[model samples]
Target: MIASTPRVTATHPSLPAVFLLGICALLNLYSPQPILPALAHWGGVTVGSAGLTISATTLGVALTAPLAGSLSDRLGRKRLIVWAITLMVACTLCCVLSTSFHQLLLWRFLQGLTIPFVFAVTLAYISEESSAGSRALVNSVYVAGTAFGGFLGRFVAGTTLEVVANWRYTFVALAVVELVVLCGTLFLLKKEANFTPSRSLLAGISGAWRHLGDMRLLLSFGVGFLLLFQQVGSFTYASIALLHAPYNLPPPAVGAVFLVFLLPVITTPLAGRINAARGPLFTYLLFSTAGAAGLAITLFGNVWCVLVGMALSCISIFAGQSASTGFISSHCQHDRSSAIGLYLSGYYLGGAAGAIVPARLYAHFGWPGCVVLLVALAAVSCVFACIAWRK
Candidate 1:
């Protein structure tokens, strides 16, 4: 059985830094999403091919997440996060220099390689540092920050591309925001007070391997995979669909549609309280069902209906993410960073497939087909939650 760790006093003041950590890590991940159509036009490729940009990055994240977790287990948390942020900023700047689609994918993949260092490490840090009572709240805040960052990145990229008519400038804008976030991280993020590094890198790897057999961890990893698969698939294709349809929204307006994310910014933090009150299994099942319903509403073909559906879907995703991460934080006793790394590897591997599979579905059967596939995935995720987390 896993032993529970004693909670430290929650550091309320550090919440802002934690929030910023979420933003900095995610600001670049999906920034290219809104401009996929524009990229296809510029690169003389199909939308599916252009989406390889997102796939490349997610693929990189999946491959590196476990290694990053192990490194954090051997290195210290804040040190790894700071170094990763610096490297991520450099990679974003390099994206601005890409003259070809393949070159852009290469830089994007490199950027993904650095993100798990910040994402997985901070999650482990929060799990270690916060008291059990406040852990859910802290995780919720971080998830909210990520939701906002995802919105901001898409908004800024789409609007900038619309205004400048140049996609490269969007990368420049993203790089600038990342620089500001880097400075805040350096100034505000606290050093780990509860970390106990592994005796060696090999030991850390061994711990990660053992996590694969833990049912709780494995189930959480499955939940994570389905969550991102639904999220990335829905939004990436929806953005492309809006570009050519009865809606005929411009890139800026589509970017504005991402304002749906702001709703989560306000609502996701409540997930902590909800998980605490209702339990993570209850929270996950409730939201997963709601997400499927929301996707069904999108088939109505009205723009307002689509926006409303998307909003519900987005909110469900953030809440489910909080619940899943909270489960890992509470259930896993040893090498929490490695556990989170494995979770992220599955999560982002789903993200990579989400980017590719939905585009192909859209190509052959259209938006309704994408919706059907995503809703089915949500249903499967709900079933897994029921089986894995049942009392």
Candidate 2:
């Protein structure tokens, strides 16, 4: 029989550790967004090229998450997380020194490479330890942490870039934050005693792959992809898209649209409750459709329409997440870290795809076309939902 992974029954002390981890993550993740415009100006690149910063990070996560996740399984979450943070700190500092777009990209990619391990370890920490009743709540807190990280990332970037003059300082601030967070983590987290390093990295990879061979697991992954695809696709570009129109808003004002993302703060917990009560499959069907519909409205190209679309999208995400996470927590009684990793791999991959493709649509076809693209993705998500839930 395959060895059963050790579970985290509960951790009274890990709470602050979770918070510190999220804050440090926010530092690395958001630096590019605020500095993108400056980077573009310095390098003479377009807005879409600036968006590549986000995409590069996602790409790095996609390429490295599996390896990182696997190594984490063998090496232990504390080691992987510490190593990942150290790398992120280094990459973030490098961002401040980058002279050109390519240099920034290189640093961002390295930064991206470390992110998945951080997220994978965090999710593993939550899943391993939290009680079944509180698991969803813990997951929501973790997601909230990511959202807060995103919020702060954008917040720091949007508020300071113009005043700071040197966009490099944006990353410098980020690096400092992560460095402080890093220092605290050393004392806060207790390393897992049960960590059994995999015989080889390949062992963790092969093990996860074999487990994911199930169709249900595959469907769960699809749900994660769609959830993040639409969310990231829409919001990552939200600031830029709004600034173009009648609103012609400033960068900071545009960043306020991230408030839509904050809606998840409320929805995530509610979704978890629904997930606990209703089961994962049913919740996904209900909420995923809501998100699709919201995106449909945003395509209409009016300010009010876009705002409404944004809210619906947030609601849809929570619903879909509820179901998707329910299925993950319930089904993968063992090797749940791998399950979370697979889900995240698909999720971040979709995030990466959204970062690149939707912007291209906006650049060429305009706002209406962007909506069309989002709608089509939503439609595809709907089909996946139907198939996955059918079981």
Best by TM-score: 1
Clashes of 1: 0
| Cα lDDT tens digits for candidate 2, 241-330 | 788865687876666676675666567667767666666656666676777788778777677888888888876775676567556755
Candidate that would win on lDDT: 1
**Candidate 1: tens digits of C-alpha lDDT, residues 10-91:** 4666788888888876788878877889899988899878978877887788889999999999997999998998999899
Cα error, candidate 1, residue 49 (Å): 3.3
Local distance difference test, each candidate? 0.86, 0.71
RMSD of 2: 3.5
Instruction: Check candidate 2 and list the clashing pairs.
Output: 8-128, 8-129, 74-197, 74-198
Model 1 error, position 237 (Å): 3.5
Clash number by candidate, in order: 0, 4
